[model samples]
Target: MNKPTSIRMCAASLLAGLSLLLSGCFITPGKFTSELVLSQDESFTFTYEGEIFFLGLSSLAQMGAANEEFTPQECYDEDTFEDRECTEEEIAEQRAAWDAGAETRAAEAKKKAEEMSVMMGGIDPSDPEASEELRRILLRHHGWDRVEDKGNGVFDVSYSISGKLTHDFMFPVIEDVPMTNPFVQMIIRDDKVVRINAPGFSAQEGDNPMGGMAGLAGLAALGEGASGGNGADEMPDLPKIEGTFSIVTQGSMKIRANNTDEGPNPTPTGEILTWDISPRTQNAPTALIAFGQ
Candidate 1:
């Protein structure tokens, strides 16, 4: 007779199996705030700060392995294939096995966390002096930017980008490339911002890499005739995006109109515009900044 495992253990194992299939395409939800400061001479400066949160299976695996309170039991007898009672000794033995596996699971979890951290955070959360690979990518696409140390888990970035580039066709293409994965883009025409696109994250389309395990686990449970399985319409509660965007023009320039889809607030300072945004899908704009001529 096959050995019985805890429902949680089976769920974790099922997730592990699914993790392999859904590795690359996962959505992460997060928040951001950005400001575009434009000079009268057409020089442009943009600033951004934000945070993202996600759940990875490695975290789940670590939790499962570390938890020893839960016990596994065989519901049927091996001889007559009838119902049976699980003994205290059997539960203790199974708990011991899980305990032995905890160390290995912890190590694996650490490695996976590191990988995901780099992919999402773009830098080590603990080390600020580490390589600026993500920053370099931003420079290549946006402009040569400066990073300011905010001293307490905060970063303030300023970029002096080419104003001429905004009006060019290549701006959106360059921004959307896989390497940068920038959340915001601007398109200018006739020395004015004709359109701005903030295309949000990949998480909106059900590509969340972290939630893939739950999806697979649910399927496995349903296949096994588990009565408590969630319905197909139900989805994991994942993070969504909320943020603010602003633009201000210096000197004689004026924002004749705010054509952005978000319909941000206009500052009393004149030529200053702001938008509070919540992104629901990739195709939907979180914030679009348009300056009227």
Candidate 2:
């Protein structure tokens, strides 16, 4: 169990375990429409209407820990790299090693779950009560106009807020929920430059940090013998990232840089930059704006 050996195994199995080990804390966007309006006087209004997913890393880890099943170690020819029958002594030795470490691994997994629960405000994604708890938490905030749990860790929410750009801002800032990668961010510099980015708004493969948890859940379902052609249906229903994001800027502000494909389109109010996001989107939306003529 301790020695590194290349054994023939399904790549899905590796991904299943890796997802549990590395999924960690993260929040990502789902279907939604978002907009930001920036004025010449450094005032702004931001609105987001759509799904917000919260993945509980501890619950994922606990699932992994509880579902771990041992597969017999395989022996292979060193030179040819071909599978061969393992010796009786070798098999016994591997079993002994696995048994020796089982207790330690369980203890470590338990400790990690406990620590993560604290970090995530004791909300367990696997718990039936988690959705209501999350709704209550978000409703206590100012911007959240509505919060409805759509199951499978997805929440349909409507958030609208306005303020002067006196400091940096980030969305989905829930109280007691430890900070993870944000859905959207605006960083204001002392030089009167503002950088806007929507990291979790795109379907780019690696852009969503919590993306792996979906696979983890699917694998867990499969491992539990979810069959009869309904395994896919039984898998957790994670929301997809499909939405639109736009930014409106006053004419007095200078647009230094932006990644919009068609450039800014003129509107009656000012210039608007938009992105139609989907699974095909390869990059997240971003832009830079500077104050003063």
Candidate 3:
């Protein structure tokens, strides 16, 4: 099964360039809430629950139509210094073709968005026996275990993924995977250097094991209407994405500590920390938690 172009882009580009530009994209508004627990025995667990609104999908479809209909004045006469303007009939034909193409693309986008919306909205963090598919997603994507729905868009989960770190502050450089891949991770230095455990992802890996609708490169132009997004001036007003992430952690740990950079800070209460996470447009949201020896 070939992976979608959007997934490939996410796996390859989200961390480096796209991660920084997510807010300007067309990710629907929603909330992500998570709880992480690291035991004294050097083990960790993470639970996440949240929703991603798909109301903006229609706008995205419209953007696709716009892109399809766009045609640039060309230097059709290569040897001449004059640019060739498209005739009205030519323009009409182009518009018709674009509309025809956009209809198919728009329909596909709409279907995908609706499916994703249902799946995301089905997460009941409070349910002890939530969808097994959702549980599988958490485990495979984030290496979490004992996944439990916390109800009301909260989750009771923990991360079982653990690895040793090289230094107290050295961020483990995992090649290919984006830092904001919506997956949970942990690292521990076995040489008595230090141990670090962290769990994240209030939303289970978007809409798939590879990547979600966010990975669709075909939808790239759809984000043009987003606030501060490309072509925003001529584009229609895009709906504002609304949501936040409430995170809590137990055991001994620090979030975004050391020399590593971090996203917006969340409220901290002893071991619990909460962040205001908005809908991501370019890349998935991520938080880094650290433990000091």
Name the top TM-score candidate. 2
Give the per-residue lDDT of model 1 (tens digit) for 111-140. 765664554444443344422443454457
Candidate 3 whole-model C-alpha lDDT, 0 to 1: 0.38
Q: Whose TM-score is higher: candidate 2's or candidate 3's?
A: 2
lDDT value, residue 106 of candidate 3: 79
Model 1: runs farther than 4 Å from truth?
1-32, 38-40, 50-181, 187-195, 201-242, 249-273, 278-293
TM-score of 1: 0.42
List per-candidate RMSD values in Å: 9.6, 5.3, 12.6
lDDT, candidate 3, 188-241, per-residue tens: 444332333221222223444223333333234333322224444534333332
Candidate 3 Cα outliers beyond 4 Å, as residue runs: 1-29, 52-180, 190-270, 279-293
Clashing pairs in 1: 26-207, 26-208, 26-209, 27-203, 27-207, 27-208
lDDT (Cα atoms) of all candidates against the true structure? 0.46, 0.71, 0.38
- What lDDT score goes with residue 146 in model 1? 56
Compose the digit string of candidate 2's lDDT tens values, residues 34-71: 99999877799999999887656223333443545665
Cα TM-score per model: 0.42, 0.76, 0.34
On lDDT, the leading prediction is: 2
